[model samples]
Target: MPRTKGNHEARRRDVSEAVWRVLVAHGFGGLTMRAVAAELDATTGLLTHYFPAKRDLVAYALDLLERRSASRPRRAAGKGLSAVRAALLDILPLTDEATDSNRIWVSSWDAALANPELSDDYARKYAKSREKLRDLVAAAQQLGELPDGDPARIAAGAQSFVLGLVVQALFDPPAFPSHRQAELLDDYLATLNSPPSSGGDHEILS
Candidate 1:
Protein backbone atom coordinates (compact mmCIF):
# COMPACT_ATOMS: atom_id res chain seq x y z
CA MET A 1 0.00 0.00 0.00
CA PRO A 2 1.11 3.53 -0.71
CA ARG A 3 1.98 5.46 2.43
CA THR A 4 0.21 8.73 3.28
CA LYS A 5 2.01 12.06 2.76
CA GLY A 6 1.76 12.96 6.44
CA ASN A 7 3.46 9.70 7.32
CA HIS A 8 6.24 10.52 4.94
CA GLU A 9 6.55 13.98 6.44
CA ALA A 10 6.72 12.57 9.94
CA ARG A 11 9.45 10.22 8.89
CA ARG A 12 11.14 13.06 7.05
CA ARG A 13 11.30 15.07 10.27
CA ASP A 14 12.75 12.11 12.11
CA VAL A 15 15.25 11.48 9.35
CA SER A 16 16.12 15.14 9.16
CA GLU A 17 16.83 15.28 12.89
CA ALA A 18 19.05 12.24 12.54
CA VAL A 19 20.87 13.86 9.64
CA TRP A 20 21.40 16.93 11.82
CA ARG A 21 23.04 14.77 14.46
CA VAL A 22 25.46 13.26 11.96
CA LEU A 23 26.23 16.57 10.28
CA VAL A 24 26.86 18.14 13.69
CA ALA A 25 29.08 15.33 14.85
CA HIS A 26 30.75 14.98 11.47
CA GLY A 27 30.73 17.16 8.37
CA PHE A 28 28.64 16.78 5.23
CA GLY A 29 31.19 14.43 3.72
CA GLY A 30 30.62 12.18 6.68
CA LEU A 31 26.83 12.16 6.30
CA THR A 32 25.08 9.12 4.87
CA MET A 33 21.73 7.43 4.96
CA ARG A 34 23.31 4.47 6.66
CA ALA A 35 24.85 6.62 9.35
CA VAL A 36 21.58 8.42 9.96
CA ALA A 37 19.63 5.18 9.98
CA ALA A 38 22.03 3.70 12.48
CA GLU A 39 21.86 6.81 14.59
CA LEU A 40 18.10 6.46 14.69
CA ASP A 41 18.31 2.68 14.94
CA ALA A 42 16.31 2.48 11.75
CA THR A 43 16.99 0.87 8.38
CA THR A 44 18.17 2.43 5.11
CA GLY A 45 14.76 1.64 3.67
CA LEU A 46 13.11 3.75 6.33
CA LEU A 47 15.59 6.58 5.88
CA THR A 48 14.96 6.43 2.16
CA HIS A 49 11.30 6.49 2.89
CA TYR A 50 11.74 10.09 4.01
CA PHE A 51 14.86 11.30 2.19
CA PRO A 52 15.19 9.25 -0.94
CA ALA A 53 17.89 11.43 -2.43
CA LYS A 54 20.91 12.99 -0.78
CA ARG A 55 20.02 16.36 -2.28
CA ASP A 56 16.57 16.11 -0.71
CA LEU A 57 18.25 15.50 2.59
CA VAL A 58 20.57 18.46 2.16
CA ALA A 59 17.72 20.75 1.19
CA TYR A 60 15.70 19.65 4.18
CA ALA A 61 18.62 20.20 6.49
CA LEU A 62 19.21 23.68 5.10
CA ASP A 63 15.57 24.59 5.50
CA LEU A 64 15.58 23.36 9.09
CA LEU A 65 18.73 25.30 9.86
CA GLU A 66 17.40 28.50 8.33
CA ARG A 67 14.06 28.31 10.12
CA ARG A 68 15.64 27.53 13.46
CA SER A 69 18.26 30.19 12.93
CA ALA A 70 15.68 32.89 12.28
CA SER A 71 13.14 31.96 14.93
CA ARG A 72 14.78 33.44 18.03
CA PRO A 73 15.59 36.81 16.52
CA ARG A 74 12.11 37.16 15.12
CA ARG A 75 10.61 36.44 18.51
CA ALA A 76 12.90 39.00 20.13
CA ALA A 77 11.61 41.66 17.73
CA GLY A 78 9.04 43.29 20.05
CA LYS A 79 11.25 43.12 23.11
CA GLY A 80 13.69 45.90 22.12
CA LEU A 81 17.24 46.37 20.84
CA SER A 82 18.60 43.97 23.39
CA ALA A 83 16.17 41.34 22.18
CA VAL A 84 17.24 41.96 18.60
CA ARG A 85 20.86 41.58 19.62
CA ALA A 86 20.08 38.35 21.38
CA ALA A 87 18.37 37.05 18.26
CA LEU A 88 21.38 37.90 16.13
CA LEU A 89 23.66 36.02 18.48
CA ASP A 90 21.46 32.95 18.15
CA ILE A 91 22.47 32.85 14.49
CA LEU A 92 26.17 32.65 15.22
CA PRO A 93 28.07 29.36 15.31
CA LEU A 94 29.25 29.65 18.89
CA THR A 95 27.54 26.73 20.62
CA ASP A 96 27.64 23.08 19.56
CA GLU A 97 24.28 23.08 17.74
CA ALA A 98 24.90 26.48 16.17
CA THR A 99 28.44 25.53 15.25
CA ASP A 100 27.20 22.47 13.42
CA SER A 101 24.54 24.42 11.51
CA ASN A 102 27.02 27.19 10.70
CA ARG A 103 29.65 24.73 9.57
CA ILE A 104 27.21 23.08 7.18
CA TRP A 105 26.06 26.46 5.85
CA VAL A 106 29.58 27.82 5.36
CA SER A 107 30.72 24.63 3.68
CA SER A 108 27.64 24.61 1.50
CA TRP A 109 28.27 28.22 0.51
CA ASP A 110 31.82 27.34 -0.53
CA ALA A 111 30.54 24.39 -2.53
CA ALA A 112 27.91 26.63 -4.11
CA LEU A 113 30.70 28.76 -5.55
CA ALA A 114 31.52 25.95 -7.96
CA ASN A 115 28.13 24.30 -8.08
CA PRO A 116 25.72 26.44 -10.09
CA GLU A 117 22.73 24.41 -8.95
CA LEU A 118 23.22 25.34 -5.30
CA SER A 119 24.25 28.95 -5.79
CA ASP A 120 20.78 30.45 -6.10
CA ASP A 121 19.51 28.93 -2.85
CA TYR A 122 22.63 29.99 -1.00
CA ALA A 123 22.44 33.53 -2.33
CA ARG A 124 18.74 33.79 -1.60
CA LYS A 125 19.10 32.75 2.03
CA TYR A 126 22.13 34.98 2.55
CA ALA A 127 20.28 37.98 1.16
CA LYS A 128 17.21 37.25 3.26
CA SER A 129 19.25 37.06 6.45
CA ARG A 130 20.91 40.37 5.63
CA GLU A 131 17.54 41.98 4.96
CA LYS A 132 16.19 40.69 8.25
CA LEU A 133 19.09 42.33 10.07
CA ARG A 134 18.49 45.51 8.15
CA ASP A 135 14.86 45.53 9.16
CA LEU A 136 15.73 45.03 12.80
CA VAL A 137 18.15 47.94 12.71
CA ALA A 138 15.56 50.09 11.02
CA ALA A 139 13.11 49.27 13.78
CA ALA A 140 15.63 50.45 16.34
CA GLN A 141 16.12 53.67 14.42
CA GLN A 142 12.40 54.29 14.13
CA LEU A 143 12.14 54.03 17.88
CA GLY A 144 14.67 56.91 18.11
CA GLU A 145 16.72 54.53 20.15
CA LEU A 146 19.56 54.42 17.68
CA PRO A 147 21.65 57.45 16.76
CA ASP A 148 22.08 59.38 13.49
CA GLY A 149 23.54 56.84 11.06
CA ASP A 150 21.90 55.65 7.84
CA PRO A 151 19.88 52.60 8.79
CA ALA A 152 20.54 50.73 5.56
CA ARG A 153 24.27 51.21 5.65
CA ILE A 154 24.44 50.83 9.38
CA ALA A 155 22.49 47.60 9.27
CA ALA A 156 24.73 46.20 6.57
CA GLY A 157 27.80 47.27 8.51
CA ALA A 158 26.45 45.72 11.68
CA GLN A 159 25.76 42.47 9.86
CA SER A 160 29.26 42.54 8.47
CA PHE A 161 30.68 43.05 11.94
CA VAL A 162 28.71 40.12 13.36
CA LEU A 163 29.81 37.98 10.43
CA GLY A 164 33.38 38.91 11.11
CA LEU A 165 32.97 37.97 14.74
CA VAL A 166 31.59 34.57 13.80
CA VAL A 167 34.32 33.95 11.23
CA GLN A 168 36.93 35.00 13.73
CA ALA A 169 35.55 32.56 16.26
CA LEU A 170 35.90 29.78 13.69
CA PHE A 171 39.54 30.71 13.11
CA ASP A 172 40.45 31.55 16.72
CA PRO A 173 38.85 29.60 19.51
CA PRO A 174 37.82 31.00 22.93
CA ALA A 175 37.52 34.53 21.59
CA PHE A 176 33.77 34.67 20.76
CA PRO A 177 32.27 34.19 24.17
CA SER A 178 28.58 35.15 24.60
CA HIS A 179 29.29 37.95 27.08
CA ARG A 180 31.95 39.43 24.79
CA GLN A 181 29.57 39.13 21.87
CA ALA A 182 26.96 41.02 23.86
CA GLU A 183 29.48 43.76 24.58
CA LEU A 184 30.45 43.88 20.92
CA LEU A 185 26.78 44.18 19.96
CA ASP A 186 26.30 46.99 22.43
CA ASP A 187 29.31 48.75 20.96
CA TYR A 188 27.95 48.34 17.48
CA LEU A 189 24.56 49.69 18.54
CA ALA A 190 26.22 52.68 20.12
CA THR A 191 28.06 53.40 16.89
CA LEU A 192 24.82 53.25 14.97
CA ASN A 193 23.44 55.88 17.32
CA SER A 194 26.37 58.25 16.67
CA PRO A 195 25.78 61.66 15.09
CA PRO A 196 25.73 61.99 11.33
CA SER A 197 28.00 64.57 9.70
CA SER A 198 26.70 68.08 9.03
CA GLY A 199 24.32 68.74 6.08
CA GLY A 200 24.00 65.00 5.31
CA ASP A 201 20.70 63.73 3.86
CA HIS A 202 19.90 60.73 6.08
CA GLU A 203 16.23 59.90 5.39
CA ILE A 204 17.02 56.78 3.40
CA LEU A 205 15.51 53.40 4.36
CA SER A 206 16.42 50.66 1.95
Candidate 2:
Protein backbone atom coordinates (compact mmCIF):
# COMPACT_ATOMS: atom_id res chain seq x y z
CA MET A 1 0.00 0.00 0.00
CA PRO A 2 1.16 3.53 -0.69
CA ARG A 3 2.22 5.56 2.32
CA THR A 4 -0.14 8.27 3.50
CA LYS A 5 0.81 11.98 3.60
CA GLY A 6 0.83 11.84 7.40
CA ASN A 7 3.39 9.04 7.31
CA HIS A 8 5.59 11.07 4.99
CA GLU A 9 5.33 14.08 7.27
CA ALA A 10 6.18 12.00 10.34
CA ARG A 11 9.25 10.63 8.60
CA ARG A 12 10.31 14.14 7.63
CA ARG A 13 9.87 15.32 11.22
CA ASP A 14 12.03 12.45 12.42
CA VAL A 15 14.69 13.40 9.92
CA SER A 16 14.53 17.03 10.94
CA GLU A 17 14.97 16.14 14.60
CA ALA A 18 17.99 14.01 13.81
CA VAL A 19 19.47 16.79 11.69
CA TRP A 20 18.98 19.33 14.50
CA ARG A 21 20.72 17.09 17.00
CA VAL A 22 23.71 16.66 14.72
CA LEU A 23 23.87 20.38 14.05
CA VAL A 24 23.78 21.31 17.71
CA ALA A 25 26.45 18.78 18.59
CA HIS A 26 28.93 19.39 15.78
CA GLY A 27 27.83 22.28 13.60
CA PHE A 28 27.69 22.07 9.81
CA GLY A 29 31.31 20.99 9.50
CA GLY A 30 30.49 17.75 11.29
CA LEU A 31 27.07 17.12 9.78
CA THR A 32 28.05 13.98 7.89
CA MET A 33 25.55 11.39 6.67
CA ARG A 34 27.06 8.85 9.01
CA ALA A 35 26.74 11.21 11.96
CA VAL A 36 23.09 11.87 11.25
CA ALA A 37 22.40 8.21 10.61
CA ALA A 38 23.94 7.32 13.92
CA GLU A 39 21.93 10.09 15.57
CA LEU A 40 18.74 8.67 14.09
CA ASP A 41 19.88 5.09 14.67
CA ALA A 42 19.03 4.44 11.01
CA THR A 43 20.92 3.31 7.98
CA THR A 44 22.69 5.65 5.56
CA GLY A 45 20.39 4.30 2.86
CA LEU A 46 17.39 5.82 4.60
CA LEU A 47 18.99 9.23 4.65
CA THR A 48 20.01 8.89 1.03
CA HIS A 49 16.39 8.21 0.18
CA TYR A 50 15.50 11.57 1.68
CA PHE A 51 18.66 13.46 0.71
CA PRO A 52 20.56 12.12 -2.24
CA ALA A 53 23.56 14.38 -1.67
CA LYS A 54 25.34 15.94 1.27
CA ARG A 55 24.53 19.36 -0.10
CA ASP A 56 20.85 18.45 -0.10
CA LEU A 57 21.09 17.46 3.54
CA VAL A 58 22.92 20.67 4.35
CA ALA A 59 20.31 22.77 2.61
CA TYR A 60 17.53 21.01 4.49
CA ALA A 61 19.37 21.57 7.75
CA LEU A 62 19.69 25.28 7.05
CA ASP A 63 15.99 25.49 6.28
CA LEU A 64 15.22 23.70 9.51
CA LEU A 65 17.26 26.23 11.43
CA GLU A 66 15.35 29.09 9.85
CA ARG A 67 12.02 27.42 10.62
CA ARG A 68 12.98 26.82 14.22
CA SER A 69 14.14 30.40 14.66
CA ALA A 70 10.94 31.80 13.22
CA SER A 71 8.85 29.66 15.53
CA ARG A 72 10.66 30.56 18.74
CA PRO A 73 8.56 32.31 21.37
CA ARG A 74 8.77 36.08 21.37
CA ARG A 75 8.50 38.42 24.33
CA ALA A 76 5.14 40.00 25.12
CA ALA A 77 4.22 42.33 22.28
CA GLY A 78 4.68 46.03 22.99
CA LYS A 79 5.07 49.18 20.96
CA GLY A 80 7.82 51.72 20.32
CA LEU A 81 11.25 51.33 21.90
CA SER A 82 10.03 48.70 24.31
CA ALA A 83 9.07 46.48 21.40
CA VAL A 84 12.41 47.10 19.74
CA ARG A 85 14.21 46.12 22.92
CA ALA A 86 12.21 42.94 23.20
CA ALA A 87 12.96 42.00 19.61
CA LEU A 88 16.67 42.63 19.99
CA LEU A 89 16.85 40.69 23.22
CA ASP A 90 15.26 37.73 21.50
CA ILE A 91 18.30 37.54 19.21
CA LEU A 92 20.88 37.49 21.96
CA PRO A 93 22.36 34.22 23.20
CA LEU A 94 21.06 34.81 26.69
CA THR A 95 19.77 31.29 27.24
CA ASP A 96 21.21 27.84 26.72
CA GLU A 97 19.03 27.14 23.69
CA ALA A 98 19.71 30.54 22.18
CA THR A 99 23.44 29.98 22.69
CA ASP A 100 23.29 26.68 20.85
CA SER A 101 21.31 28.23 18.02
CA ASN A 102 23.81 31.05 17.76
CA ARG A 103 26.64 28.53 17.60
CA ILE A 104 24.93 26.71 14.74
CA TRP A 105 24.44 30.01 12.88
CA VAL A 106 28.05 31.06 13.38
CA SER A 107 29.23 27.65 12.20
CA SER A 108 27.08 27.90 9.08
CA TRP A 109 28.76 31.16 8.07
CA ASP A 110 31.80 29.36 6.70
CA ALA A 111 29.65 27.16 4.45
CA ALA A 112 27.43 30.07 3.45
CA LEU A 113 30.35 32.31 2.55
CA ALA A 114 31.88 29.60 0.35
CA ASN A 115 28.80 29.03 -1.84
CA PRO A 116 27.23 31.78 -3.93
CA GLU A 117 23.68 30.50 -3.59
CA LEU A 118 23.93 30.08 0.17
CA SER A 119 25.60 33.47 0.42
CA ASP A 120 22.69 35.11 -1.38
CA ASP A 121 20.20 33.22 0.75
CA TYR A 122 21.87 34.40 3.95
CA ALA A 123 22.07 37.95 2.63
CA ARG A 124 18.34 37.96 1.96
CA LYS A 125 17.56 36.61 5.40
CA TYR A 126 19.62 39.36 7.06
CA ALA A 127 17.94 41.98 4.88
CA LYS A 128 14.52 40.78 5.92
CA SER A 129 15.47 40.89 9.57
CA ARG A 130 16.84 44.40 9.17
CA GLU A 131 13.61 45.50 7.50
CA LYS A 132 11.59 44.31 10.48
CA LEU A 133 13.92 46.15 12.82
CA ARG A 134 13.72 49.27 10.68
CA ASP A 135 9.96 49.36 11.11
CA LEU A 136 10.35 49.12 14.87
CA VAL A 137 12.96 51.88 14.90
CA ALA A 138 10.70 54.09 12.84
CA ALA A 139 7.84 53.54 15.26
CA ALA A 140 10.06 54.34 18.21
CA GLN A 141 11.22 57.54 16.57
CA GLN A 142 7.66 58.54 15.88
CA LEU A 143 6.79 57.96 19.54
CA GLY A 144 9.68 60.20 20.60
CA GLU A 145 11.39 57.28 22.32
CA LEU A 146 14.36 57.60 20.01
CA PRO A 147 16.04 60.59 18.44
CA ASP A 148 15.26 61.40 14.81
CA GLY A 149 17.39 59.68 12.21
CA ASP A 150 17.07 57.35 9.23
CA PRO A 151 15.20 54.32 10.50
CA ALA A 152 16.98 51.94 8.13
CA ARG A 153 20.37 53.17 9.25
CA ILE A 154 19.39 52.94 12.90
CA ALA A 155 18.06 49.43 12.38
CA ALA A 156 21.22 48.35 10.60
CA GLY A 157 23.29 49.66 13.46
CA ALA A 158 21.15 47.81 15.97
CA GLN A 159 21.44 44.60 13.99
CA SER A 160 25.20 44.94 13.74
CA PHE A 161 25.44 45.57 17.48
CA VAL A 162 23.38 42.51 18.37
CA LEU A 163 25.27 40.26 15.98
CA GLY A 164 28.63 41.46 17.21
CA LEU A 165 27.51 40.80 20.78
CA VAL A 166 26.34 37.34 19.79
CA VAL A 167 29.77 36.53 18.37
CA GLN A 168 31.51 37.82 21.46
CA ALA A 169 29.22 35.91 23.80
CA LEU A 170 29.67 32.73 21.78
CA PHE A 171 33.42 33.06 21.80
CA ASP A 172 33.76 34.11 25.44
CA PRO A 173 30.73 33.19 27.43
CA PRO A 174 32.53 33.78 30.68
CA ALA A 175 33.21 37.38 29.80
CA PHE A 176 29.71 38.07 28.48
CA PRO A 177 27.14 36.35 30.61
CA SER A 178 23.42 36.89 30.07
CA HIS A 179 23.18 39.80 32.50
CA ARG A 180 26.20 41.48 30.93
CA GLN A 181 24.68 41.08 27.49
CA ALA A 182 21.42 42.63 28.64
CA GLU A 183 23.23 45.48 30.34
CA LEU A 184 25.27 46.21 27.24
CA LEU A 185 22.17 46.13 25.06
CA ASP A 186 20.44 48.60 27.40
CA ASP A 187 23.44 50.87 27.23
CA TYR A 188 23.34 50.85 23.45
CA LEU A 189 19.63 51.57 23.40
CA ALA A 190 20.11 54.42 25.84
CA THR A 191 22.37 56.13 23.36
CA LEU A 192 19.57 56.16 20.79
CA ASN A 193 17.61 58.51 23.00
CA SER A 194 20.22 61.23 22.73
CA PRO A 195 19.44 64.03 20.33
CA PRO A 196 21.50 64.16 17.16
CA SER A 197 24.76 66.09 17.57
CA SER A 198 24.72 69.79 16.63
CA GLY A 199 26.80 69.09 13.52
CA GLY A 200 24.06 66.87 12.08
CA ASP A 201 22.43 63.49 12.41
CA HIS A 202 25.49 61.25 12.26
CA GLU A 203 25.58 59.34 9.01
CA ILE A 204 25.12 55.62 9.66
CA LEU A 205 25.55 53.47 6.58
CA SER A 206 22.96 50.75 6.40
Residue 79 accuracy (lDDT) in model 2:
98
Best TM-score goes to which candidate? 2
Clashes of 2: 0
By summed lDDT, which 10 consecutive residues of candidate 1 come out lowest? 71-80
Give residue 23's lDDT in candidate 1 (0 to 100).
72
The CA lDDT at 169 in model 1 is 68
Candidate 1, residues 107-200: lDDT per residue as tens digits? Answer: 5565577778678877786677778777776777677766645666766777778777777766565777766766777787676667755553
Candidate 2: where is the Cα deviation over 4 Å?
A: 1-8, 197-206
Strongest candidate by lDDT: 2
Q: For each candidate, how many residue pairs have backbone atoms clashing (under 3 Å)?
A: 1, 0
Task: Give lDDT: candidate 1, residue 30.
Answer: 68
What Cα-based lDDT does every candidate model obtain? 0.70, 0.93
* TM-score for each candidate, following the candidate numbering: 0.73, 0.90
Model 2 steric clash pairs: none
